[model samples]
Target: MFQKILIANRGEIALRVLRACKELGIQTVVVHSTADADAMHVRLADESVCIGPPPSRDSYLNIHQIVAACEITGADAVHPGYGFLSENAKFADILAAHNITFIGPSGDHIRVMGDKIEAKRTAKRLGIPVVPGSDGAVTEEKEARRIAAEIGYPVIIKASAGGGGRGMKVAHTETDLEIALQTARSEAGAAFGDDAVYIEKYLEKPRHIEVQVFGDGFGGGVHFGERDCSLQRRHQKVWEEANSPALNAEERSRIGGICAKAIADLGYSGAGTIEFLYENGEFYFIEMNTRLQVEHPVTEAITGIDLVHEQIRVASGGGLSVRQEDIKFNGHAIECRINAEDPRTFTPSPGTITHFHTPGGLGIRVDSGVYSGYKIPPYYDSLIGKLIVHGRNRVECMMRLRRALDEFVVDGIKTTLPLFRDLVGNADIANGDYDIHWLEKYLAKGE
Candidate 1:
């Protein structure tokens, strides 16, 4: 076990990792920007270091400063709690070269899975189902049109190195393909510094399902099941549920087994998510996240597994803590990502939190790094917290989630709490009859 672990991020995830380390009796060091001097994670850490100013490029993303922090604190491992440098293959390699451990997959695995084009090829090669599309990036307009023609109309152009909805454009017909390709490539070059784009058959009315898998880096791995992240806005997940309401026990088992086998075959390590678009009883691979997801709490609630604890254990060479047969799914769980934004307008709301209150009882958990009187800086993400609820079944889970949403409160800033309240009461959300496009359509209705 590592004696000390440095957390290389901020906000709720940083706090989440700190709690796990504390539970395992390991000391923690948290690096923060000047803007986060009063951040909750920094306040609660065993030791804290101010890396740089408010800008992410100068602070959180600065590799050299992070390495210096590790050396100064004598920290042996780094747990990048999502975002920032979590998926940076170069960062992982640098840490390894410095004799410090990155508590995730190897740099090579990160490199392969980080690129959408290569990830699709790897997924298909691993016997995982994939969307029918181009074999690789299509740089010329002629090739893009050819692939779209072969795949039929309504194709989507996506950046080879894109995420969070950027560098993506959909074309409903051949006429729209040229403009869509140009727009996607322009956006890709601007956002990721890579002009490479690929085409994929776009699926309508598909539910976004992602399977969570963990590995010990020694050819052993297990799947914890799936999360239905179909409720999204602008490609960002707003709500997530475990043991997808859209899937049955058999379907869940089949998909989970396939993902587990893939991870084991690659000899991967730590936590990863294999995302797919499920439509017409078929699962088409999208991409893989090489780190812990923001919606992981829902999975933990259903499986009774502490993923962070397992991540630390596996990274430290202790191997997986349990066998595949030892894992069991227990209940239904849901997570609502509460961001500091206008519920109706979806504009960022950054200000001091004057009053704060969280819900409690059986089956309710709030993961946040904010408190009353804390001034939320506009320099970072608008997400302030996550509310996760668990129950014996889907019905009970929704009931509990509704009650919890009503009980959560934050003042002095606009928040999406009201949106969740409205969503939980809607017939579609209540019945779990929603897809990736459902939320946008619901918002368009202004009901």
Candidate 2:
């Protein structure tokens, strides 16, 4: 195990990794932007370093500054909590060149899996079912139109190197494809520095399910289970639940096996997620996340596993501690991403938090970094914390989540607490009868 590790992110994820390090007897050096000089992670870490200015390019996303911070702190490895440089293959390569391990997959694996188009190809080659559409990059508008024609109308143009729903456009007809193709290509180039986009048959009302898998950087891996993240808005996940009610044992096993095989085929290591879009009783590989997800706590809650610790152990050249047969899903777990924003407008509300309180009790887990008197920054993600709860079943889990959300309080800034309160009470969510677009429709109704 690493004696000391540098966390290359901030906010709740940084705090989450710090707690895991503390439990593993590993000292942590947390890197913070100048804007985050007084951040909770900075205060809690055994060592803290300011990388650069507030803008992500000058700070959190600055690879050299992060590597230098690790070198200075004598951190044996670097754990990128989630976003920013977490999925950057170049950052992983830099750490490897510095002889410091990155507590995730190898640079090669990330580079392969990071590209949505390439990942789909790899999955197809490995016999994993993928959404039918363009087999490769669509460089020309004609090729995109041709692919769309073959896949039928209502095809989706996706960035080769995209995630979080950016660089995507839907076209239902030939006329729509021409404009959607051009716009998607331009947006893809701007967002991911890749002009290449591909086509996929868009499934209406699909359930967003993902498999959480652990690997050893060799040919062996194990899957914990799946999470249903269908509760989303603008293609970003707002809520997640483990052991999706939408999936049965047979479906779970099939998807889990495919995910494990795909990861193992790529020699993936540490923790990662294989995302899929489920529709019409079939699962289609969407893409893979090469880092711990923001909603990982829900998986941990149901599995009784410490994913961060497992990440460190895997990075230290240790194989998975548990086999596939040993893994079992104990119960249902739900996670609500508590963002510092308005419930109605979805606009950020960053300011000094005059009062902060979190719910605690049986099966309630609050992963947070800020506290009372802390000022929420306007330059970063709107996320303030994560409220995760576990129970014997889905019904119990929902009840617990509602109770916990009710107890959570943050003053001096508007939050999504009320939105979550409404969501848990929504009939669609209560009956698990909603898809990815449910949240948007719910918000439209202003319920």
Which structure among the candidates has the greatest lDDT?
1
Model 2: residues >4 Å from true position, as ranges? none
lDDT by residue (132-215, candidate 1, tens digit) is 999999989889888998999799999999999999999999889999999999999999999899999999899999999998
Q: Which ten residues in a row have the lowest lDDT in candidate 1?
A: 139-148
Each candidate structure's count of clashing pairs = 0, 0
lDDT (Cα) of model 2: 0.90
Q: Please, what is the whole-model Cα lDDT of each candidate in the order they appear?
A: 0.96, 0.90
Q: Could you give me the TM-score of model 1 versus the true structure? A: 0.99
TM-score of each: 0.99, 0.98
lDDT of 2 by residue, 258-374 (tens): 888877876778898988899889999899888999999999998898888889888998877888888888889999998998989999999999999999889999999999999
The RMSD of every model to the true structure, in order and in angstroms, is: 0.6, 1.1
Residue 281 in candidate 2, Cα distance off native in Å = 1.1
Candidate 2: give the clashing pairs. Answer: none
Task: Work out how many backbone clashes candidate 1 has.
Answer: 0
